[model samples]
Target: MSRAFTFPGQGSQAVGMGRELAEAFAPAREVFQEIDDALEQKLSKLMWEGPQEDLTLTENAQPAIMAVSLAVVRTLEAQGGFKLADKAAFVAGHSLGEYSALAAAGSFTIADTARLLKKRGQAMQRAVPVGQGAMAVLLGLEFDAASEIAKEAAQGEVCEAANDNGGGQVVISGAKAAVERAIEIAKTKGAKRSMLLPVSAPFHCALMKPAAEEMAEALSQVDLKAPAIPLVANVTASRVADPATIRDLLVRQVTGMVRWRESVLYMEAQGVTSYLEIGAGKALAGMIKRIADKEAAIASVGTPADVETILKTL
Candidate 1:
């Protein structure tokens, strides 16, 4: 069966996420060590033994999550005799996980991916002053309906849909007041629930234009190669293997809504029958299940034991 590999993004991180994998496998430990060397910080320590505050920071969480995902990828290749290039039809990730997908597919070196994600996190955090921007989830509303509500609630502000996660879950981000306004409007427009997200900055909206610019500049300097497998970009919701297109889309993704539902459908239509989430959490697997066909299988690899278990699938 054809399978696609997907990675998790923010909100999937937790203390001690990669500790088990690192402890059980030498390759997993090496992935964390490489990342720590690249960033010159013992982030893995915080990830394994956090007071919770520093590990939760966007700058730290971005690369930390990627490290775990790549650790899983490296482990499968090392011990399971699994090769993504030979087995997977496509690869994708949600938000920051895109870097993990790229790195796993050999588009970017793990070190470069780590450095880029660190910059991305810092740039995103600095794009808007905290407390002036926010994000919220609107459940039970279709994307078109949520988009309309966001537009109406904007009132010349920056409210916009950020993530169209399947099963009627839509996330909106922009100015704080506009986000709250959109939440109220969504409630009136038949939303089952709308609540503010505890996020440090509004992401994937007009307010992120500055972050997009920053990423453009940073991405220009980073060397990118075509991945061994196709990557379904978040903004375009289609497979992209060209290095140039990947660079441009990554910049746009900073301000573009994550079209996750469409991306999953695109893979499903292209003959992918299974999805493998190699990361700290099962967020992408959960979303894929909601958007995929009834027969599609979804699995996650978060620890050394999971790696051994999935070997039977291959």
Candidate 2:
């Protein structure tokens, strides 16, 4: 069966995410230690024993999620003898998870991925002041409808579709007023439910232009190699393997729509019949099930038992 490995994004993070993996596998512990060394912070501690507020901070959450995802990958490699290049037809991630996918596929070192995500989180947080920018979920609306609603709500401000997560879930982000307006507009337009998300900053919208610019500079300074498998990028929802092009896409992704639904569809079209969500949570697996709408094999590998279960299949 053709397979694709997916990674989770920001909202999937939680305290004690990788504690099980770290305890169960030496390689997992090594991954966490490497990330701690790279960032010069004991992030694993915060993740294992957190004040949820601190772990939820964008700067902390982004790399923390990546660290857990990589820890799982490392465990799978060591325990299952699984090789991504041999098994995965493609890899993809939502927002910051793209870096996790890249790190798993060997495009970037684990340490570099951790550091890059740290910088990305900080840049995104700094792009706009808290409360000035916001994001909202517009459920029961298609991407086209959500896009129009965001446009109408802009009112000379910046409101745009951010994440086209399938299952009639779309996230719009921009100026707080604009996003709030979009929520109300979505209500009038037959949305099942519309509510503002409690995000620190507007992500994946024009308001993140400064963050995009910052990422461009940050990505330029890093050495990125072509991945062992092609990545279905968020901005394009298509396969990309050229290192230079991938770097550019990562920059654009900061302010561009996360075409997650389309990306999954693209993978399905490419004959990816099995998807492994190798991360902290099963959020991506849930989305993939909705997106594919087929009897595709989907699994989440985050713990030792999860890893062993997948290994048997492998």
All models, RMSD in angstroms: 0.7, 0.7
For model 2, residues 186-242, the per-residue Cα lDDT tens digits are: 989999999998789999988899989998999999999999999999999999999
lDDT of each: 0.93, 0.93
The residue ranges of model 1 lying beyond 4 angstroms of the native Cα positions read none
Model 1 agreement with the true structure over 1-314: per-residue lDDT tens digits:
99899999998889999999988999999999999999999999999999688888999999999999999999999886767798799999999989999999999999999999999999999999989999999999989999999999999999999999988999999999999999988878999999999889998998999999999999999999999999999999999999999999999999999999999999988999999999998888888888899899899999888888998888
TM-score of candidate 2 to 2 decimals: 0.99
**Worst 10-residue lDDT window, candidate 2:** 77-86
TM-score of each: 0.99, 0.99
**Candidate 2 residue pairs that clash:** none
